[model samples]
Target chain A: MVSALGIQLGVVGAYLLVALAVGLLAYRLTSRDAEDYYLAGRSIGTVVLLFTTFATLLSAFTFFGGPDLAYRAGPEWILVMGVMDGVLFALLWYVVGYKQWLVGKAHGYVTLGEMLGDRFGSKRLRALVAGISLFWLFPYVMLQQMGAGEAIVGLTNGIVPYWAGAAGITVFMIAYVVIAGLRGVAWTDTLQGLFMLGVVWLAVGWVATAAGGPSALSNALATNKPEFLALGGGLYSPQFIISTAITIAFGVAMFPQINQRFFVAKSGAVLKRSFALWPVLVVLLFVPAFILGTWAAGLGISVPEGANVLPVLLNEYTPVWFAALVVAGAMAAMMSSSDSMLLSGSSYFTRDLYRPFVDASLSDAREAWIARIGVALFATLTFVASLFRPGTLIEVGDTAFGGFAQMALPVIIALYWARTTRSGMFAGIVGGQLFYLAHVFVPAFEIAGITVLGGTYLTWDFALWGMVLSALLTLGVSSLTAAAPEENQSRFSEGLRAD
Target chain B: MTRTSIDYLWIVTFAILVTFAVPWFLWGDSRVFAGLPLWLWWHIGWMVLAAVVFHLFTRRAWDRGIVEGGR
Candidate 1:
């Protein structure tokens, strides 16, 4: 490790120095109050809101995983996942996101749990939500760490060890989050988002051009793996149904970071304008990762299973300068997600946990400081998890996504449907979580004449399928029960728009 | 039908047209749509829907008086 990429130690030092600078800046900005720390005093306009939303949702995984999925599972999975993500944002651009931001602003809710608990009149619900957030977010943080390590390794040609990269990323992330709070996160996210767009466009174009263009790559891949061209490749089994897509699409608008994007928007008009441009952003950004992945497969590069595909591919194909930019882009992706999660994580602990339970009398300034420490603590723990777990960060982060999506149907149904009761949301959350866990960890069941797919034996990740069972339980239970208190029911809709 | 129901049907019809009808007609045989890629078509669908939804909002929002709110 000492003689690694062997760039002078100063190179790594500069990265850490920039991170510390960013963190100090954020910490100073946020040291005053929770409002400023948590939501940037709602000062973000359309431009900042647009970039922050874009970067916060994209990470090294979104950039790398598309190509990784293409390389390992064939092309079907990339198309399915990529298209699902696109559809998800489009759906959010419409109905779901508006409801979230409007309701959140009307009541000063920071965490989804806070929003749900306030609406449903249950404090325990808040705790349940915060706990679930911690459960899944830890892995996401770990993924950023893993991505940090992989990016450094690719750039230095394994001159840097995994732990150094992880520690470097962790320090940078913690500093950045503490320095700017939401303000820093938003500005850096905006910069990183724009920077990475250029990086991805160049990488994809270069890869395709080197391989003799898109059609030639398509021809090469067709010869090697024909299913790479199919909607559902051989045994890859792309789940491209309308219902399945609708399920994935609808769930996208509901991610906590995405919902939080709404809370900071200057106005609904700003949000709408940003969302209107989102499709172009989507195509410009993630679609390139997919094209690069397909191009890699065409060039006959045997990409490793679950590796950081974009940087790995870029390192293999492009020049050192471009490769360095890809490395920087990977770090930017890591920082994008980490800063948002740090602010978001601290918000849950401060607003949802501390203020609600142990320290209501604490000054907002003190709470803001506590949030800085909380970011540090969260960063440390997730780093430790990445160190210990090592390989599962990306998938675990995806699993954590289910934590948000599982809550989606109930949240939306409760918001829109008059028949939706507190019990519905509660049952939906609890039942959905249990079903999701069981469908993930438990097995199939065969009783009497009926045989359940995951009931009798433990099976694979049934993310969308789990939501179906959960949704049924929520709706059925709600229909059989009385409605929530009318006061609670009408609070959200009063200030929100269905358009 | 009532106005809201008409709006709902409009969304459903648009969903079907782009999600299926257009795709089936133009790229049913995997041919690109006028040399634009398949993914571009999806992008077009996303952009078109976005334009339509926001256009309707600006045109018919009919908020006689809107309230200023906080976060």
Candidate 2:
């Protein structure tokens, strides 16, 4: 009899080959220019734009970490993402994305830093925005690599080492991004997104049925693990849920990869439709994944403590063929997310940092070359970090989310508040980051009714504090400073007003 | 609808629904329904309500000030 590992690897291998084929197809179709390469020539339609953003945002965290959290914590984690993320992310996409699209289209802007920098009339602000974005973005990219590595180790039953898994994805993702750019990323993301959604539902359906169906699974949890069904169950607290929801929504808004998608939309209607349908997609994916995770206890499937439960759950409970498909789907999630991130990182480096600081007069073709090189370097850095295995995927992901959340205030103010000076925006970004870092790194101190470098209020996390503090600094500084010149302010209004 | 009028409404509704409006009332209760907790259902209800609010905002006012005037 063939080893189960062999069958699983074969299935996953075949799936990845298809992904490569899709990338090569995109390469053939793509035009050799920055516009075509980075933003898909700014012509992405509703379905592709929606799925690419969805798949990239969902990532390995959604596939692997979501199940792990649900399995270990409880179903409340589901509501944290499913209900909250659906509404919050869609709302943000509507509010920020539409305006960004308008401005980006008018000016041919491609990166978030470009928008913020031009609005504030400060190149330093652009560099700062890119710097903060890269700082937060690296850990998220590393989380994908780490998740890929862990999934491989679990699926292969340690037939493969962790470094090999991490390196395999790193190399594959580099090839995918370098070949296809944004068009390829979007096309492949659409295909992989649908594949992941289909296989996930299939895995969940088979598992739930084999475990005696949904009602039986529910009954088992209700009887044995009541905490798993209720609020504040397992690892969830009220404050944690609230903080996480707020941070995730804002963090997503600022993600270079997600923000750049706003520029790729074909029209405002396409963007609107994408945001409108986003919550529905989240509901479909999250509801089943969380339910199956809860049902794992009912099935009495055992995984090593702190291991990724998704692969183990599949391998033990399903057919080898199905198990392989699910693993590949998870890998697809990682690749789809990583490619966009690698692509976005390249844009940040080339457009924001390289062009402004290194060579303002470089040809567009040379800029694209630098961008391609940037992608390889950024992916290499993350791959090396993943080998160290610094933290759990969720923890690292949350840190990145929190950093981006702190930037939301400055970004929003820069967009809408013409009075917002470059100094104020800069202060808001730096001050919030400084305070949040202090909160995270410095030991807590309290003296004379003052708490310094603290983490939480009542039970809420530091992100809330950081957001409030950042907003205050922005408002306070803006109130005291001279606004941008009248012409600049009018230009901003002209750009922001809906046409 | 005026821009701020709609924007502020979304802000208030989301604030009330997400931060204190719904979750506060549901958190204390521990009842389960249809394989999900009462609180979870409430959050889902908020999602539906939010979807409706978003649909209205996008239809009536999303591009009110920009699309026709600026471009």
Candidate 3:
């Protein structure tokens, strides 16, 4: 008879091998062209586009952090992440993503920096955007590796060390990205996405049935942790809920991996269908994890100090093989997200950073080679950072979200408002980043408060203030500066006006 | 692109949906329904409604602002 540890290792190993095989298969279908490598030749169908976007955006945050928050804080996390974000991000997909697709199709643009810099005729702005994106992207990329490490340790009961788990994922991700590019990433993402969804739902069903059904869990919660079933529990305050919702929605819109996807759909119909289905998909995946987490609280599941609640609960309640499969699904989430980030980060480096500043006359083949090298180096750097384990997954994830949220106003203005100038863009991007950083680094400004009813009661999150400042600077600075040339401005607007 | 009534309606509908997505009205109420809290149920219903609204928008008005204009 096989030991439990051996079965777990076997399951996880099998999952990794299948992922590698899928990625290598994608390379055969991929061409040598830069566009084909980075954006899948801009021919992704609705299903592939939807699943890839879903897989890339969900990440370790959704699989691990969502359950952890629900277990600790309550079900209000659903409001912040699931219900609010689902609708808001879908709307942004229509408003921001649709415009980006149109503009990208017209100009053959591959990166956000390329689109913005060309519109304003400023290489510095391109480099600035790329630099900021890459800076925030590091923490998020490290987040996946960190999640992978913790997940493996929890699943294997520490038979696999954290560093080994993190390193294994990092190496596999780099190899997969270098070999397959976006085509492989998307195909694998679809498989991984399906795998994650299936395993999560299965785990939820198996656990809930064993616990005597959904009503029994609710009754157990009502008997034990009644505060979780209600609002105003000091954690999910109105301001906290609203601020988190807004920041995450806008932040997701600016993620380089997600933004690049706006340029990859085969047709407007594909984009329309994908966005329309996005919220439903979000609900499907989120409901299970959060519900299981809340149920765990009532069931008296005791988690170790540093281990994640979801994995711990799974191990205690589910069968060994199913637990391993769920952990593999979590690994799928991490690998899918990390591979996409590295791929998009490479594009930002090659097109925006290296070409304009380092070598303008590089050939496409050389550019592709440089991008692959950049992906490897960047992934290695983040893997090293992940080994440090600076912050919790949610803390690191929130900080990254706040950093990206600063870019949303400037990006929206550049795409829609014709009078947006390079000076304005620079001010908005730099100023918002500074203000956000100040708030993050300095505790006093993280929550600006006012004395109300003889107490310091009214407060707001830093992201709200950061976004407000960004909008003000973008509009104020643009009004005081000369607009981009009329012809250059027309490049963004003409296609929208064609009908 | 020409502004259509569907676009305006979508904006207004989303604004209302967002305002109510949070269960502020259900604050301090601990009523349970169908194995979940009433507030949680509200979010579930709201998400379903949001999806329906998106489906309607895509079928009725997505082409006007994006596909036709982009052409």
Candidate 4:
């Protein structure tokens, strides 16, 4: 008999080759200019823009980690992604993205640091923002690499080592980004988004139906694991749920990869249309994953604790070919996210750090060259970090999300609030990171099974403390300091009113 | 309708409903509705409501200047 693992890897390898071909095709349409390379010539249409954003936002964490969480905890986890994030993030796109698009278009910005730096009139602040983003982003990029490694190991039953899987993806991503830049990343992301959206639903739907319909699945949980269907169920408390929703919403708003997407949008209407449909897409994709995860419990499918539940479910319920396709689909989600992040991180280093600080007069072609190199360097670093496997994909992703969320207050203040001085923005960012990092790095006490941070008496999540303290410091410092120049305030206010 | 400050109310309402209003009151309720718990459905319901709210919010006058640029 032909090796089933060999056949599965063959199918996955074929899918990856097709993605590479798409990147080359996009290269033909790309221009040689730095703007075109980094921002896709600012010419992305509605459907492509929407799906790229969707695919990039829904990463390996969403595809693999979400199902695992639902299986491990309960259906309450669905509320975290399916319900709150769908709507909350869409609104945040409008509130933050619209402004960013307007300002970026007017100023010809390619990175968030550039925008923040110009608005604050401080190169140090721009470098600081970019540095902070990269610091948080490293773990997030590592999570995707680690997720791909775990997925490949799970799919092939350890025939392929974890290090090989991570290295293969890192090399592929560097090739993709170098071939077509943002345009290539966007085209492939659109294709992968559609693949992930379709394959996940079909595979999960098939599995759930095979394990008896919804009611039967529900009946099994009610009989043996009613707590899985109950409120205050599993690991999520109400405070945990509420705080995560808040953190994720703010986190999505400030992600460097997601933030840079505003600059690639073809027009304001395209961005608007994408945000409007975001929640619908979230519901469609997420509901099935939750159902399938909950159904796994009912079917008594045994998954190793902390391992990805997806490959386990597919192995038992689906055929080899179908499981291969599902694994490929999961890899697609990881690749789409990883490519965008690599591109964004490189742009931060090139546009925000290198051009601004290292060589102010660098030529456009040379800048693009530096950016491609940055992609390779960043991907390699993240790949190296993935080997250590510090945390699970979801845990690593959540830590990054908390850091980004802390920056949201400073970002909003920088944009909408006129009195926000450079000092205020700087202090807000530092104070927030200090508070959040202190909590994250220091071990917390587990008293009676509730995790309490070392200093805080209550069990409230660290993200809440970071955001609240950051916003207060921003406000208090801005009030004490002289306002930004009148010219700057008018410039921002004018951008807000433009229509 | 021409955009006014009031166009933000629905989102404000949406924010409150998801983050504070419903989660505090209804999320801990253990009643099963559909195949999932009541609070889970409440979140789904809020998603639908949020869609409607965002649809209305987007319809309000937004800066059209950015829409008429390079294709």
Candidate 5:
């Protein structure tokens, strides 16, 4: 393990060098403008867009957590989670994404806030949304940085130290962000993604071989964790299953950063193509992780109680070189998710907050610089916030996911529901977000059996209940208020294309 | 009676099959349905059946769309 530290520095250094080269290449193509800095001037081609989106979407959760869950739970979790991811993207393709892409193109909408602003004829609401988006996304961004640190430590096994690894990764990230902005992030993401994907396949093959081949491993796993083998039952309580499925499915719809990615798509067709690739990733990549998980279970390996089983299993089974690759892959996933998110979240801060509200007279070049500055600040805060790692990854997931659902009220109200007032939308958002947080945090502070408002955190399964309350609040508030101003309704309908 | 919602319902059901149901069913066992409990196979069957059709439909839709602009 001590010697493995040498490999860690070498591999991580190599990957960082490759990543920086991609950033430098991207920097060569841009000029000093906010548009270029933020959205690649809204002109990314289909292939780069597709690959980058693919790379961006598969974070540490999918890469590491999939195997972890599988190792702990069984085949059923993998089957459901994998299928749900594909299903989620497909729905994104068919139902909402294309239309959003079209509307975004028509209006030069770069951020979800911009989309809401245009749709609602209310800059204040846009700012509100921008605020919500930033708040919702911060923890997610922090998690990525946190993962980068964790992967470094895991990959090195305390040789590098978690703090040093985290700080080193963050410094590298800031340098990348300053050099190329979105272009650099997207380009490096593509190369990193391909590298990580290759590493996953090789690791799977190697592990399968070491375990006396796939058949024997499967047989062994079944004897040990027959519940996992059961597929349907013994996998998860029914409530957790529904929660898992719904949270992933609808929860995806609310992410503003993902929403922003839609605009970079060249057309609706690319949107569909992207969705098509989503399932294949699950089958090819995630399934193997789950299989690895199954293999780990047979060994009776222990992990962080809340963590899935792969870390312990990986430590036990895989070769050092492969471990480095797995570490690199996990780190890559974190970098991919965080870089894009940090960039987007900071866009809201700079674009909606500073550019429009703080300094309307700023030049395009100045705007670009401010955006770069925002990235630095956001990263620093996210890194700091991560020191207080929230409960389980799932709890953090719910908070972020629920935050977006709170904004879903404004999104739907602005686009489809015309009767919504800014006051109503704003009120609904506040009510929903507060209610969700209360449900999440209040129980811990509760005295005896009574919750603060006599409500629950909507724990694993009750996320849907939170979403429903948010939507209902938005709708009810809007109805009780006066109709939205006439022009806002027109712009919203036009933007929504509610023919 | 031409009902869009009803049409959508059928579409959704087919969607459920293609999107998340089929692949789950077909792939849940060892090498094309060997040696697994009856209920286990049923669960896998549902997942594969839903998932495979979903994959095909997704690809088909992607193949059908024109992703570029400024023609």
Candidate 6:
């Protein structure tokens, strides 16, 4: 008879093999052109686009962090991630993504830097945007690796060391990304997305039933921790909820992986349909994870740390095979996110940073090859960084989100506002980043015992302030600076203006 | 491509939905219904309403200048 550990490992191994097979199959279908490799030839249909975007956006954060937060803080996490960001991000998809698709289609742009650079006629600005995106993206990519490591270690009870687990995913993702690029990433994302959804719901049902269903779970919570049943107390303050919601929504809009997706849908109809369904998909995944986490608290389940709550709870309540399947689902979430980030990061380096700055005359085939190399190097570097285990998954993820949130103002201004100049964009991007860093790195300011900047001021997160500063700089600087040439402005504005 | 009354209506509708999504109104109320808090039930209904609004928006107003202009 097979041992429980063997069965668990077998399920995870089988999942990885299937993922690799899917990636290789996509490699066969992919063409050699840069566009085809990077953006799937901009021909992704509604279903693939929806699932890929869904999978790419909902990472270890949703699978692990969401449950962890609910376990500690309560169900108010549902307010922050589920109800608020779900609808808000979908709105942004329409407000910002639609316009981006139009502009990208018209210009044949592949990266955000390329689009912004062309609009303002500034190569330096393009490089700046690429640099900042890469800087923030690095931590987020490492977040996935760290999550994979911890998750694998959690499932195997230390049989698989953290470094090996991180390395395993990094190697697998790099192999597939280099093999088929966005085509493989998207196809695999669809499969992994489906796998994650099904497994998470199953885990929720099994655990809930074992705990005597939702009513019993709620009774447990009501008796043990009643604050979780209400709102506006402790960590679930009104300001905390609103600020987190805004920051995450805007930050998601600027994620390089997600932003690149705006240009990948085959038609406007596909884009519309995808955004329309995004909120519902988000709800379906987030609610179950958060509810389970909240229920864990009531059930008096103990975990080493918040991040370990889901895995520990599953082991205690569910069957061994089911636990392994859920762990694989969590791995699916991590790999789906990491692969997309690596693929998009490569596009940024090759198209925006290297080609324009290093070798302006590089051939398309050579550029594609360079991007593959970049993915390998990038994945390897982040894998090594993941070994350090810098911060908790939520802390590291929040920092990256805030960093990217600084870019949203400049992007929106560049897209809709005609007067947006290259210098203004630079000032906003750099100034906001510096200020945010000051808040992050510097100790709280005090003048003779009076508190100032650093940490949440009056309950608002530093990210909200960073975004406000970014917008002010962008608008203030653009007003004083000369506008880009009217013809250049018209490239975006002419097509986007309502008739 | 032109802005319509329907577009304005959706903008207002979504704005209201977002405003009420936060359970400030339910502060200090710990009533549990069906083994869940009243606030949780509020969010469940709110999300369902939001999804419906989104579907309606896509049918009625999703295509603006971008779609037609791209084609």
* Whole-model lDDT values for every prediction: 0.63, 0.76, 0.81, 0.75, 0.62, 0.79
True-contact fraction for model 3?
Answer: 0.59
Q: Report fnat, model 6.
A: 0.61
lDDT of 1 by residue, A1-499 (tens): 3443343344445544664565456556645533453554555678877887788656755665556666666544434443455444555555566666677777876667788788777777787777766666676777778777766665665666767878888877776665555445666666667777887788877877766777777777667755555444353332333333444454445555666666666677776677556655766676676767666776677544334566567767776556666666557666866778777777777777888789779897898799888889888988887776444434555666665678777777776675777777778888878876765566667778655645222323466766776687778888998865532766676765522
lDDT of 2 by residue, A1-499 (tens): 2588788878888888788887778656654533464644677788878888888755877777887778777767777785457877776786688878887887778888887888778788889989989988898998988888888887777777778878888888887777665446766777788887888899887887777776677788878777776667446776777788889889888998898888888778798788667766877777777666767765566766435778878887788888878888778667877888877877888889988999989897787777788878888999999888777877788888899999988877766676888778878999999978787668998888877666677677888889988998998898898866622554445644343
lDDT of 5 at A140: 70
Clashes of 3: 0
Q: Estimate how well candidate 6 is docked, as a DockQ score.
A: 0.53
> In model 2, how large is the Cα lDDT of residue A430?
94
Residue A471's C-alpha lDDT in candidate 4? 96
Query: Which prediction has the highest DockQ against the true structure?
Result: 3
Reference-based TM-score, model 6: 0.93
Q: Write the per-residue lDDT of candidate 4 for residues A1-499, one digit (tens) a residue.
A: 2588778888889888787887677666554533454544577779877887888656877777777778778777777875446866776786678878877777777788888888778889899999999899988888888888887777766677888888888888777777656546776777788877788788866876777766677788888677887676457876677788788778877788888887777787797788768777887778777667777776677865335677777878888888888887777667767887877887788878888789999997788788788778888999999999988777888889999999998888777787888878888999999989988898887889876666333666878888999999998887898855522554455543343
Model 3 misplaced stretches (Cα beyond 4 Å): A29-40, A442-458, A484-487, A497-499, B1-7, B63-71
Candidate with top TM-score is 6
Q: Is the docking of candidate 4 incorrect, acceptable, medium or high quality?
A: acceptable
Ranked by lDDT, the better of candidates 3 and 5 is: 3
If the candidates were sorted by their DockQ against the true structure, best first, what order would they fall in? 3, 6, 2, 4, 1, 5
Worst 10 residues of 3 chain A by lDDT: A448-457
Model 4: residues >4 Å from true position, as ranges? A29-41, A180-182, A444-457, A484-487, A495-499, B1-8, B16-41, B61-71
Who is ahead in DockQ, 2 or 3?
3
Native contacts retained, all candidates in order: 0.05, 0.33, 0.59, 0.39, 0.09, 0.61
lDDT of 4 by residue, B30-49 (tens): 56665566776676676776
Candidate with the larger DockQ of 1 and 2: 2
Against the native complex, each candidate's DockQ, computed on alpha carbons, is: 0.20, 0.40, 0.55, 0.35, 0.19, 0.53
